[model samples]
Target: MKGALREALQRARVDKVPVALVTQLEGGAQNLVYSSDQSNAEISLGSSQLEEIRDMLRVARSGMLPGDEFFVRSYVPPYRLLIVGAVHIAQALSVMAAQCDYQVTVIDPRRAFATAERFQGVELCAEWPDEAMARLLPDAQTAVVTLAHDPKIDDPALIAALGSGAFYIGALGSRRTHGKRLERLTDLGLEDQLQRINAPIGLKLGGRGHAEIAVSILAQLIQARYGG
Candidate 1:
């Protein structure tokens, strides 16, 4: 509630950085702990307490530590889903992602497929995949999925997502298709980053329908987010 702490929290929110506000229950003293390199000089925490705070930050959970002497309130950036190539699978995925509290955005250069009528209540970007990814600057809290299936669209977005800190990167493709895609990406000098992509995007749910595929993708994405 102090001016300095308030400003730090505001900055963290703006920068999409995860942090925890730790308040001592007895003395009412407070310290801010960031999940990354940013730190608060006002108070120094022991390694054990720092690790506990980090665990809370990872799960975005707020609660008292083991001793109940301090309460940690987690403040994490909103989870985001950026779907490249606003196609049929994207329509379903967007809806599902929104239901799971993701701020969903569908991007495509083709205006016809990225229309609001089709992707109701979802953010639609009418720019090319690379352009949109560059502007969005996908962060650790963001997930990028390529459902466009077109190399021209999916490849650029994959390249951008691979280069970013986006936590999840998935592409819809068959095993054979993914092999070809991998070759193409390798040719583009992305061999090292290829492992980060969930190529046959989604769990092996054995569901072939668009909605079922969406479910599988969401399941895998949640697993990735939770380190499952």
Candidate 2:
């Protein structure tokens, strides 16, 4: 691999971007392609061959495309979880999400609560929900959840998330709470966007406690990702 190719691979890893390497069948000429931005390293190939590789790259974004040097090798980005609130359920959910291969990030304005001790292996952001969410920029490969149950924190995060390509947006609240939440969001001019939120988040698993709730939430997230 050339220095440029190595650097591009490293950038993809560090930035969590999906990329692909296409190699010529005869001379082993190589090209680097990014699935996120569709940027590519220099390589000589026919437009027809290039389009085929691009189609493969698109399919690879969901998972990895099978087979090797026959044509193209792809690397896909890991899915991400942007969780608002560092509460107990968040801690449990973060752990579960990590086991499910999600790059978990927990955001909370209360620095004392969003501590490294509680969320050991997860990323912690000690900023307001909206500020942190804006920096994160949840995409199609991301899941956003508001577990805080506080309007001041969760609502702002929702504003940023709903406007993004986040695959799943869930909030922790009941029917009554969601009703009140909709009213507040309507006042903020988000009435049309209310349906995007999966209020009363998590599946009806007939379980209680933080751990059970976390399991239910993860189950619903899996269902959303894989589809029914």
TM-score for each of the candidates = 0.83, 0.80
- Backbone collisions counted per model: 0, 0
lDDT of 2 by residue, 1-228 (tens): 677777878888788666778765556666776643444445665566556667776656322224443357777778899999999999999999999999999999988889999999889998898889878899988999999889899999999998999989999999999999889888989888889899799999988899999999999999988786
Worst 10 residues of 2 by lDDT: 61-70
Which residue segments of model 2 deviate by more than 4 Å?
A: 1-8, 22-31, 35-49, 59-71
Question: Could you tell me which residue pairs clash in candidate 1?
Answer: none
In candidate 2, position 167 carries an lDDT of 87
Model 1 worst lDDT window (10 residues): 36-45
Write candidate 1's Cα lDDT for 1-228 as tens digits: 688888988898899778899888786778888876445544566889889889989889999988888889999888999999888889899999999999999999999899989988899999999899999999888999999989999999999999999999999999999999999999989999999999799999999999999999999999999899
Clashing pairs in 2: none
